[model samples]
Each structure stands twice: as structure tokens, then as C-alpha cells.
Target: MRIYLKGLRIYATIPRIKDANKLAKYYTETNKELGIDVTLDKISAKEFIKTAIVNFNSMKEFHFGIYTKNHKFIGLFSIIQPNYSKRICEIGYWIAKKYREKKYGEDAIKIITDFAFKTLKMKKIFAFVNTNNKASIRLLKSAQFKKTHTSLKSATAFEKTGTHISTYVLHLAIYSDTKV
Candidate 1:
């Protein structure tokens, strides 16, 4: 996957082994700030690099690093195919601590969504955000993702407080081609 979308003060490109060190550093720092346990040990970083390489080399998916024009890493965004025949993919992303509320997330989402619909030829894309993550909800809505359905008791194990999450699904057909 080539670098796409160069404006909006941010650009995104596929992750590489060269990026592993930086990614690991970013993850460790962000996790600490978010009060989440840092799960990517040295072995885990190795495995993550291998998996990311495989996914990119095989054209199986695109995992992008959101970076400034100066090449400073800000966040990550990815589109993943759960199964081959499903013709469906899920979008996931996170911004660096200092980059939040800077519109980088919105820009990255627009770029990735365009890639999903045009380059990947995907029919549907969805995002499952925690119900309590109001920032994410606002971003998704601003990106034109509609509320399709909610899964009660969803994401119980992922949260520290064991909160239920709602799954928000959006069809690309309904989304307008806008800057977001």
C-alpha cells in the first residue's frame, strides 16, 4: 500500500519493520498514560512486526501509521478483513496522547475509508466503539458512520470496569465523499 492523503497536516502509510521500534515506544507510552497495562513485551513486539509485515506483504490488509509531514508519528489506523468471503472489514484506530483533538484522527479516517471503498473494493466497513467513548462516537458520526445496532454486554472483558460496548456499523454507500 502506498502513502495516501498528504494534506491536513498528516499522512498515513503502511507499517514496516523499521517502524516496529517506534510503534513499540508509542504503545508503551500511550498505554501508561491511559492506565492500561503494557502488553507488548519484547517477544510481543517481534511477533507484532512479523504479523504486520505478513499482512502488508500479502495485501491482506493495510495498517497505517499516521504521521506528520515531518515524519513524526501521531497514531495508527487499520482496515482488517475478518474472513475472505465476508467482503467486510472493520476499521480501528487510536491517536497519540498529544495528537488527540487535532483533527488528525478525522483526516486519517477519511483517507482510510476512501482506500477501503476504492482501493480495496470493500462493500461494507464498520467500527465497534465503546459506548462510553464519546470522543470516538463524535468522530464516527462526523465521519458519517450511522448507528446500525448495539451489542448489549459487548466488550465486557476488554474494559477495566467491565463495561458493555455498543457496535456501530456504517455502510459506505450511505456516506458522502467529504473531507470529514
Candidate 2:
């Protein structure tokens, strides 16, 4: 899928296996500071790539390579289960360290949301954010996502260091008749 959100200075395009290494490195380098875990290590790159390919090809999910106007690889933005019969989908995105404060995340979300509404004909889109992630919360809010629900003490199998996150769900109505 391809989407252009002019005001955000970014666009979303289909991802490729060639992006795996850079994407992994970007995630590994930024997770410590960002308190997020969304990548596979170098040793797991092959498996990750295969999984990404399957998710893209079989699941009908649009995994976009988030890029800058100058064609720099910023991060990833995607909608999972895009062909859901309920007309609902979830938004997932992350930006590399250097691009965090530049509003690339927000711009990427806007583009993806627009695609979901305009192209996919989705009724609504949702996102689950950790409560501690202020930047993500701000991005969702700026995109007009309203908090619809919350889950306390959500499970985190990856955090052996005892990380417990509160999950907050934000919903965006496709037919709101308002620009995001």
C-alpha cells in the first residue's frame, strides 16, 4: 500500500526483506531509551523476515516502510488484519531514534488512517498504547483517537525484568466527517 500525508512530511510504502536488518538495528538501538520492544535481533533476522513476508503476503495486512520525503527509512507503520469483516483494524507503528521528536510517527499514523478509511473502507481503527508512552499517546491524540478502553496489568512475556504495562485503547471513527 502507498499513502501520502503531505502535512506530515512522510509516506507509507510496502516493506521488504531488505529492510529487515536496518529495521532490526533501528529497533535495537532505540528500545532502551524508548522503553519499547518491537524488534528481532540479528540472529533472528531470517525468521523475522519470513514472518514479515507471510504477514504481508498471506494476511492481507499492509506493512508500510515509513519514509521521509527525501526517501530516508524512518521506521514502520502498518494496519494488522486489514480485511477484517468487522470493518475494524489496529494501527501499529514505530520510528527510529533520530526521527522520534520530528512528528514522523504522527504523520505516519495519519497516512495509515487515511488509507484505512478511504481505501480499505474501514469503519474504525484502534491502537493500544502503553500508558508510560507519552509520545505515542500524544501522537494518537493529535490524530483524533479517543480513549475507548483500558486494561490494567497487561501481560508482557518479553520483559523478564518485570515490566508491566497498562494498555490504553484509542479508537478513530472513519465516518466522523472531520479531517484528522
Candidate 3:
């Protein structure tokens, strides 16, 4: 699936082995500052592809790559499994090192949120951001996502490192007659 915006294009990552390594490498490299071990050195392209197909076919998660007008790979956007009965989903995204602070995240989020409500028929969209991630907080606000809490649950798996987060929420009704 491809979703176009004024200055960006977001498309689903093909579930092929080649695409998997490319994405995995991009992710690990881009998020290096977070002390994550996700690296090209750790997993072979073959292994990455195997994992990618399994996750891709699970139907519980979705990963989309973001690109420029020229199709330069910049980053990613994702909509994980939703509470289907409630029509609510969690949205997350990131831009490459060079693309930050340029409103790319804002534009991409706006476009995806629009698509989620209009095409996917979602009722609500939620985002979890680290409190220290001021850029993301601002990006979500620009997209009209209301800050629902001052402290959100930790995203890291159960190590319980005191990483405080903030929860943001946006409902479809807010954009009933709007286009981004």
C-alpha cells in the first residue's frame, strides 16, 4: 500500500528477504543512540528475511517505509495490531538522522492518521512517546494529538528502567471535515 502526502510517500515494506535486511540495517543504524543492539552485524540477511516474513504474514503488525519525492529512503512508520472490536490502533514513526526537525514527521503522521480514519475506519489513534523526546511531542501536537498523560508506560521490555513516557491520543471525529 502506498500513501502520498505533499512532500512524502509512505509505502508498505515488501515482505521479501532483500527488503528485510535493508530495513533491519536502516533501523539498527538509525536508532544507535538508544543503545539498541539491533545491527546488521548481529543478523545475516537470510535470517532477517525469515523473521520479516513471519512478522509480515502475522497480520498483527504493519511496517511502512517513508521516502522523499525522489524515493530516498528516510525512515519508517508503523501501525501495530489494533483492538479490532474497538477500532483503536497504536501509531509509531521515526525519521532518519538527517530528516529530523524538518516537519517530515508531522506531515507523515498527519497523512497516516487521515488514512487510518478514512480508509481503515479507525475510531482512535494513540502514540507513546518518551518524555525526553521533545521532537515527537511537538510532532504529535502539530497533528492535533492530545497529550493524555504526563507519564506513560515504559516501552522497553520489563527491565523497568525508569524511562518515563507520555501518551497522546487523537480521535477520528476531530478530523471529520479536515484534510492534511
Candidate 4:
């Protein structure tokens, strides 16, 4: 399936192995900013691609590729840890370094948030943002996600050594009434 936003197209399709090199490069370039705990010392793009395909097929999570209207791959968005019984889920996303601050992240969030609330029938969606990732915090706010009082301390090295994570949430009821 495909979702189109103002300057972006989001695809519910697995990325091809051929796109791995670029993705790996992005991973290498943005490791610090990504806030992932794993060390990609030897990021095997092929392996990553295979895992992505497997994960998509497993139905455990939903991953979408973010692209330009012209089909240029720029980033990824995901609805993770969905609890169907609870009607809640968490969101995750990363834009390539070159695409940072261009509002692609904001657009992608809007698209995914809509998908979660409307299609997945989720009551609420939340995102855990690194406290220091101002760009992402701003992006989430732009997409109408409000910060909750909750916070998490890093169990591992996340957010480039930053120790705290900020939680943000959006409810279906709130999103339904917003004009954005």
C-alpha cells in the first residue's frame, strides 16, 4: 500500500537488497543521532534487508519506507510494539542525514499516525524520543504529539550517551479533531 503526503510517498513495501548499500551508508553516517543501542561495526546491508523482509512477513511490526514524490528513498517509519488488545502502539522513524530538517519527518509522522488511528484502530500512539534530539521533538510536536510526564533512563547507550528519553503521545480522539 502507498500513502501520499504533500512532498512524500510512504510505501508499505520491503526495501530491495539493492537499496541496502545506501541504507547502510546512512546508518554509518547517522549512528550517533539514531539513538540505537547496537553497534553497527559491520553493518551488513544484505543481512539487514533480509531481516526487514522477514520482520514484515512476521506481522509483528509495520515498517514503511519514506520516499520523495519522485520515488527517491529518504528514510523509514514504523509502528512498533502494537498491542492490539490495548489498542495502543509506539512509533519510530529516522530520516537520512541529508533529509534532516526538511519536514519529511513531520510529514511521515502525520502519515503513520493516520494509518495507526484510522486503519489499525489504535486508541493511542506514543513515541520515545531522546531528550537531546531536539529536531525529532520538534517534528513530533509539529505532528501534534504531546509530551507526557513520563521519562525513561537509558539501559544502554542511546542518544549519543544521553541518559534520558522523553515520551510523547497522541490519542485518536485528539487527532480526529485537529486541523493539521
lDDT per residue as tens, model 1, 62-173: 6788888888877778877533465567788888777889888888888888877776767677787667778889998988887776332332114546655556666756
lDDT of 4 at 2: 31
**How are the candidates ranked when ordered by TM-score, highest leading?**
4, 1, 2, 3
Overall lDDT per candidate, in order of appearance:
0.71, 0.67, 0.65, 0.72
lDDT of 4 by residue, 100-123 (tens): 777777778888888888778999
For candidate 3, the TM-score is 0.74
What's model 2's lDDT at 90? 72
**What CA RMSD would you report for each candidate?**
3.4, 4.0, 3.9, 3.5
RMSD from true fold, candidate 4: 3.5
Better of 3 and 4 by lDDT: 4
lDDT of 2 by residue, 1-180 (tens): 433445358877765466767777876776666555665676576566566667776657767788788877778777776546767777777798777888788778777887778777787676766666788788888877877653222222133244433333434453355653
Where does candidate 1 stray beyond 4 Å? 1-7, 16-18, 31-38, 41-43, 82-84, 150-160, 176-180
Q: By the lDDT metric, which is better: model 1 or model 2?
A: 1
- Candidate 2 — worst ten consecutive residues by lDDT sum? 151-160
Clashing residue pairs in candidate 4 (N, C-alpha, C atoms within 3 angstroms): none
Global Cα lDDT for candidate 1: 0.71
